[model samples]
Target: MDGNKALIAYETKGGATEEAAQKIAEILRSKYQLEVDLVDLKEQKMPDLSQYRNLVIGGGVRAGRVYDKVLKFLENDLSGKRVAFFVSSAQAGTPGSYEKAKIKFVENTLAKYPKINPVATEAFGGRIKILGKTVTDNRDMVKVEAWAEELGKKFTQ
Candidate 1:
């Protein structure tokens, strides 16, 4: 594995998760000087994991469930890699339900995968649109960037 390389793999429905992945990739590359690769899970079901030492996986929540693609990806053997996980959900964005959303979508979900111990995990706000018009948008790019910065430090260590 290349210690200097990182992979930001994500699956999105309304684009919030993809945006978060991009922001994370930007911070890891520009601030940490880490070589980062962004992959959309929808396009690539399986990416060659042998080349990266750090892996960041992200997904979106819909109908109260994390994206299936991400869950499926998690089934892969991730041993010896610095893994991080994140999810984008409307509940996560709302101040009242953020903790619950984190528990349900991040904590509880990861609990099922006992073999994959992530170095960091987070739940970010999501956007909902109708007819090409945004109806609800709670995404915070600043928060995403901050998380990325922290992840960069961890990845390097």
Candidate 2:
């Protein structure tokens, strides 16, 4: 693994996951001085993972489950990589339900894949729309940026 290379791969339904992935990639590149590659798992084939020292995977949640693409991606052998995971969910954005959402969406989900030991993980708020009208906008970019900053430090360390 190249110590300075990182990959941010994600799947998004309502665009929240992709937005978070972009923010993370930006921070890793600009602040950490890392070579970052952003991949939309829905649109592109998975790149060769051997080139990256840090791997950040994320997806949006709906109906109490993380996106299928991200789950499938997690099936890869991610040993010896600095892995980080995140999810975007409406429940996570709610103050009262944040912990439950993290457990169900991030912790419990990652538990199924024993080989993946993430250096960091988080659950961010999501957005919901109905017929092109915004209904719930719970995304917090500041929180996302803060997580990325911490993740950058972990990756470099």
lDDT of each: 0.95, 0.95
TM-score of each: 0.98, 0.98
* Residue 104 displacement (Å), model 1: 0.3
**Candidate 1 residue pairs in backbone clash:** none
What residue pairs clash in candidate 2, if any at all? Answer: none
What TM value does model 1 have? 0.98
lDDT by residue for model 2 over 31-80, one digit each (tens)? Answer: 99999999999999888999988999999999999999999999999999
Off by over 4 Å in 1: none
Clashes in each model (backbone N, CA, C under 3 Å)?
0, 0
Q: Report the lDDT of model 1 for residue 140.
A: 91
Cα lDDT of model 2 overall?
0.95
User: Candidate 1 lDDT, tens digit per residue, 5-101?
Assistant: 9999899999999999999999999999999989898996566899999999999999989999899889988899999999999999999999999
